[model samples]
Target: MTQTLTLTWTTVCLLDRLEPDRGVAALVDGVQIALFRTADGLFAIDNRDPVSGAYVLSRGIVGSRDGVPTLASPLHKQVYDLRSGHCLDLPGVAVARHEARCRNGLVEVRLRQEG
Candidate 1:
Protein backbone atom coordinates (compact mmCIF):
# COMPACT_ATOMS: atom_id res chain seq x y z
CA MET A 1 0.00 0.00 0.00
CA THR A 2 1.09 3.53 -0.71
CA GLN A 3 0.54 6.41 1.62
CA THR A 4 -0.15 9.95 0.52
CA LEU A 5 1.76 12.76 2.14
CA THR A 6 0.27 16.19 2.64
CA LEU A 7 2.45 19.25 3.09
CA THR A 8 1.45 22.48 4.79
CA TRP A 9 2.68 25.49 2.94
CA THR A 10 3.15 28.89 4.54
CA THR A 11 2.69 32.13 2.68
CA VAL A 12 5.86 34.17 2.95
CA CYS A 13 5.50 37.22 0.77
CA LEU A 14 4.37 38.57 -2.56
CA LEU A 15 6.35 37.35 -5.55
CA ASP A 16 6.82 40.85 -6.83
CA ARG A 17 8.34 41.96 -3.53
CA LEU A 18 11.30 39.68 -4.07
CA GLU A 19 13.93 41.20 -6.29
CA PRO A 20 15.71 39.02 -8.77
CA ASP A 21 19.07 37.55 -7.74
CA ARG A 22 18.37 38.27 -4.11
CA GLY A 23 17.19 36.49 -0.98
CA VAL A 24 15.04 37.06 2.05
CA ALA A 25 14.60 35.33 5.41
CA ALA A 26 11.32 34.09 6.81
CA LEU A 27 10.41 32.16 9.93
CA VAL A 28 8.25 29.18 9.13
CA ASP A 29 7.17 27.00 12.02
CA GLY A 30 9.89 28.56 14.14
CA VAL A 31 12.49 27.53 11.56
CA GLN A 32 14.47 30.13 9.70
CA ILE A 33 14.16 29.68 5.95
CA ALA A 34 16.01 31.59 3.30
CA LEU A 35 14.05 32.35 0.16
CA PHE A 36 15.78 33.33 -3.04
CA ARG A 37 14.60 34.69 -6.35
CA THR A 38 16.98 33.95 -9.15
CA ALA A 39 16.74 33.90 -12.90
CA ASP A 40 16.14 30.17 -12.75
CA GLY A 41 13.27 30.38 -10.24
CA LEU A 42 12.33 30.60 -6.59
CA PHE A 43 14.24 28.46 -4.06
CA ALA A 44 14.03 27.95 -0.32
CA ILE A 45 16.75 26.69 2.00
CA ASP A 46 17.74 26.77 5.62
CA ASN A 47 18.90 30.18 6.74
CA ARG A 48 21.53 28.78 9.04
CA ASP A 49 24.95 28.08 7.63
CA PRO A 50 25.98 24.59 8.74
CA VAL A 51 29.66 25.50 8.87
CA SER A 52 29.44 28.97 10.36
CA GLY A 53 26.41 28.33 12.53
CA ALA A 54 25.01 31.71 11.53
CA TYR A 55 21.66 32.62 10.10
CA VAL A 56 23.10 34.42 7.13
CA LEU A 57 22.38 32.33 4.07
CA SER A 58 19.70 34.82 3.14
CA ARG A 59 22.39 37.43 2.76
CA GLY A 60 24.69 35.19 0.81
CA ILE A 61 25.71 36.07 -2.69
CA VAL A 62 23.55 34.64 -5.43
CA GLY A 63 25.43 33.17 -8.34
CA SER A 64 25.73 30.11 -10.55
CA ARG A 65 28.45 27.54 -10.93
CA ASP A 66 28.64 25.23 -13.91
CA GLY A 67 25.05 26.23 -14.69
CA VAL A 68 23.82 25.27 -11.20
CA PRO A 69 22.23 27.92 -9.03
CA THR A 70 24.39 28.51 -5.94
CA LEU A 71 24.46 30.63 -2.79
CA ALA A 72 27.80 31.51 -1.29
CA SER A 73 28.03 31.95 2.45
CA PRO A 74 28.88 35.48 3.53
CA LEU A 75 31.02 34.29 6.44
CA HIS A 76 33.26 31.57 5.02
CA LYS A 77 32.19 31.87 1.39
CA GLN A 78 31.08 28.25 1.20
CA VAL A 79 29.10 27.74 -1.97
CA TYR A 80 25.88 25.75 -1.71
CA ASP A 81 23.59 24.48 -4.41
CA LEU A 82 20.32 26.32 -3.93
CA ARG A 83 18.20 23.46 -5.28
CA SER A 84 19.67 20.54 -3.30
CA GLY A 85 21.26 22.44 -0.39
CA HIS A 86 24.52 20.60 -1.07
CA CYS A 87 27.68 22.45 -0.26
CA LEU A 88 29.85 22.81 -3.31
CA ASP A 89 33.09 23.88 -1.66
CA LEU A 90 32.87 21.40 1.21
CA PRO A 91 31.96 17.81 0.51
CA GLY A 92 29.61 15.88 2.78
CA VAL A 93 27.96 19.02 4.01
CA ALA A 94 24.51 20.30 3.19
CA VAL A 95 21.65 22.47 4.38
CA ALA A 96 17.95 21.74 4.49
CA ARG A 97 16.01 22.51 1.33
CA HIS A 98 12.37 23.50 1.39
CA GLU A 99 9.72 23.45 -1.31
CA ALA A 100 8.71 26.91 -2.52
CA ARG A 101 6.28 28.17 -5.10
CA CYS A 102 4.23 31.10 -6.23
CA ARG A 103 0.45 30.94 -5.96
CA ASN A 104 -1.80 33.85 -6.81
CA GLY A 105 1.19 36.20 -6.64
CA LEU A 106 2.11 35.08 -3.12
CA VAL A 107 5.26 33.14 -2.35
CA GLU A 108 4.59 29.99 -0.37
CA VAL A 109 7.03 27.63 1.27
CA ARG A 110 6.74 24.07 2.51
CA LEU A 111 9.32 22.92 5.00
CA ARG A 112 11.15 19.78 4.02
CA GLN A 113 10.78 16.90 6.43
CA GLU A 114 14.05 15.70 7.85
CA GLY A 115 14.69 12.39 9.52
Candidate 2:
Protein backbone atom coordinates (compact mmCIF):
# COMPACT_ATOMS: atom_id res chain seq x y z
CA MET A 1 0.00 0.00 0.00
CA THR A 2 1.09 3.54 -0.65
CA GLN A 3 1.61 5.97 2.18
CA THR A 4 -1.39 8.14 2.79
CA LEU A 5 -1.05 11.69 1.60
CA THR A 6 -2.93 14.40 3.40
CA LEU A 7 -5.24 16.21 1.03
CA THR A 8 -6.67 19.48 2.12
CA TRP A 9 -10.37 19.42 1.57
CA THR A 10 -11.70 21.95 -0.87
CA THR A 11 -15.26 22.76 -1.76
CA VAL A 12 -15.34 22.13 -5.47
CA CYS A 13 -18.95 22.99 -6.03
CA LEU A 14 -22.22 23.64 -4.31
CA LEU A 15 -24.48 20.85 -3.21
CA ASP A 16 -27.26 22.33 -5.24
CA ARG A 17 -25.08 22.31 -8.32
CA LEU A 18 -24.61 18.57 -8.16
CA GLU A 19 -27.71 16.65 -9.09
CA PRO A 20 -28.45 12.98 -8.90
CA ASP A 21 -26.63 10.64 -11.31
CA ARG A 22 -24.19 13.37 -12.27
CA GLY A 23 -20.65 14.40 -11.39
CA VAL A 24 -18.07 17.17 -11.49
CA ALA A 25 -14.32 17.14 -11.72
CA ALA A 26 -11.81 18.81 -9.43
CA LEU A 27 -8.08 18.90 -9.06
CA VAL A 28 -6.58 18.17 -5.69
CA ASP A 29 -2.84 18.77 -5.76
CA GLY A 30 -2.60 18.02 -9.47
CA VAL A 31 -4.60 14.87 -9.07
CA GLN A 32 -7.76 14.94 -11.09
CA ILE A 33 -10.86 13.58 -9.41
CA ALA A 34 -14.51 13.24 -10.23
CA LEU A 35 -17.16 13.85 -7.60
CA PHE A 36 -20.40 12.03 -8.12
CA ARG A 37 -23.78 12.56 -6.54
CA THR A 38 -25.66 9.34 -6.89
CA ALA A 39 -29.36 9.05 -7.54
CA ASP A 40 -29.80 8.65 -3.80
CA GLY A 41 -28.15 12.01 -2.96
CA LEU A 42 -24.97 10.36 -1.71
CA PHE A 43 -21.46 11.15 -3.01
CA ALA A 44 -18.62 8.83 -3.88
CA ILE A 45 -15.40 8.22 -5.83
CA ASP A 46 -12.87 10.41 -7.60
CA ASN A 47 -12.46 10.40 -11.39
CA ARG A 48 -8.95 9.07 -11.72
CA ASP A 49 -8.98 6.36 -14.32
CA PRO A 50 -6.54 3.74 -13.07
CA VAL A 51 -6.60 1.75 -16.26
CA SER A 52 -5.91 4.65 -18.58
CA GLY A 53 -4.54 7.38 -16.32
CA ALA A 54 -6.89 9.77 -18.07
CA TYR A 55 -8.38 11.28 -14.90
CA VAL A 56 -11.77 11.40 -16.50
CA LEU A 57 -13.83 9.48 -13.98
CA SER A 58 -16.10 12.42 -13.39
CA ARG A 59 -17.34 12.30 -16.96
CA GLY A 60 -18.22 8.64 -16.68
CA ILE A 61 -21.68 7.22 -16.13
CA VAL A 62 -23.22 6.37 -12.75
CA GLY A 63 -25.38 3.38 -11.91
CA SER A 64 -25.65 0.30 -9.73
CA ARG A 65 -25.29 -3.44 -9.99
CA ASP A 66 -26.70 -5.73 -7.31
CA GLY A 67 -27.58 -2.54 -5.47
CA VAL A 68 -23.93 -1.41 -5.22
CA PRO A 69 -23.21 2.06 -6.47
CA THR A 70 -20.62 2.13 -9.20
CA LEU A 71 -18.70 4.59 -11.35
CA ALA A 72 -17.51 3.44 -14.72
CA SER A 73 -14.39 4.82 -16.33
CA PRO A 74 -15.07 7.11 -19.23
CA LEU A 75 -12.11 5.91 -21.19
CA HIS A 76 -12.39 2.18 -20.61
CA LYS A 77 -15.56 1.32 -18.75
CA GLN A 78 -13.70 0.02 -15.71
CA VAL A 79 -16.05 0.15 -12.75
CA TYR A 80 -14.94 1.26 -9.32
CA ASP A 81 -16.56 0.95 -5.96
CA LEU A 82 -17.53 4.28 -4.47
CA ARG A 83 -17.12 3.22 -0.84
CA SER A 84 -14.04 0.99 -0.90
CA GLY A 85 -12.15 2.17 -4.01
CA HIS A 86 -12.12 -1.36 -5.23
CA CYS A 87 -12.30 -2.05 -8.93
CA LEU A 88 -15.35 -4.17 -9.54
CA ASP A 89 -14.12 -5.64 -12.81
CA LEU A 90 -10.48 -6.00 -11.95
CA PRO A 91 -9.03 -8.09 -9.17
CA GLY A 92 -6.20 -6.90 -6.94
CA VAL A 93 -6.60 -3.37 -8.25
CA ALA A 94 -7.85 -0.30 -6.47
CA VAL A 95 -8.23 3.40 -6.81
CA ALA A 96 -7.51 6.19 -4.38
CA ARG A 97 -10.37 6.66 -1.99
CA HIS A 98 -10.95 10.16 -0.77
CA GLU A 99 -12.45 10.82 2.62
CA ALA A 100 -15.47 12.92 1.75
CA ARG A 101 -18.06 14.62 3.90
CA CYS A 102 -20.44 17.49 4.00
CA ARG A 103 -19.87 20.35 6.40
CA ASN A 104 -21.70 23.66 6.62
CA GLY A 105 -23.79 22.54 3.67
CA LEU A 106 -20.68 22.10 1.54
CA VAL A 107 -19.20 18.89 0.26
CA GLU A 108 -15.51 18.35 0.97
CA VAL A 109 -13.11 15.64 -0.01
CA ARG A 110 -9.93 14.85 1.90
CA LEU A 111 -7.53 12.75 -0.10
CA ARG A 112 -5.79 10.63 2.47
CA GLN A 113 -2.86 8.38 1.78
CA GLU A 114 -3.69 4.71 1.79
CA GLY A 115 -1.90 2.52 4.29
- The TM-score values for the models, in the order shown, are 0.93, 0.83
In model 2, what lDDT does residue 64 have?
82
Q: lDDT of all predictions, in order shown?
A: 0.93, 0.75
Runs with alpha carbons beyond 4 Å of true place in candidate 2: 1-5
lDDT of 1 by residue, 12-97 (tens): 99999999998899999889999999998999999999998999999999999999999999999999999899999899999989
Q: Looking at model 1, report the run of 10 residues with the lowest lDDT sum.
A: 1-10
Cα displacement (Å) at residue 20, model 1: 0.6
TM-score of 1: 0.93
Give stretches of model 1 more than 4 Å off. 1-6
Estimate candidate 2's alpha-carbon lDDT, on a 0 to 1 scale: 0.75
TM-score of 2: 0.83
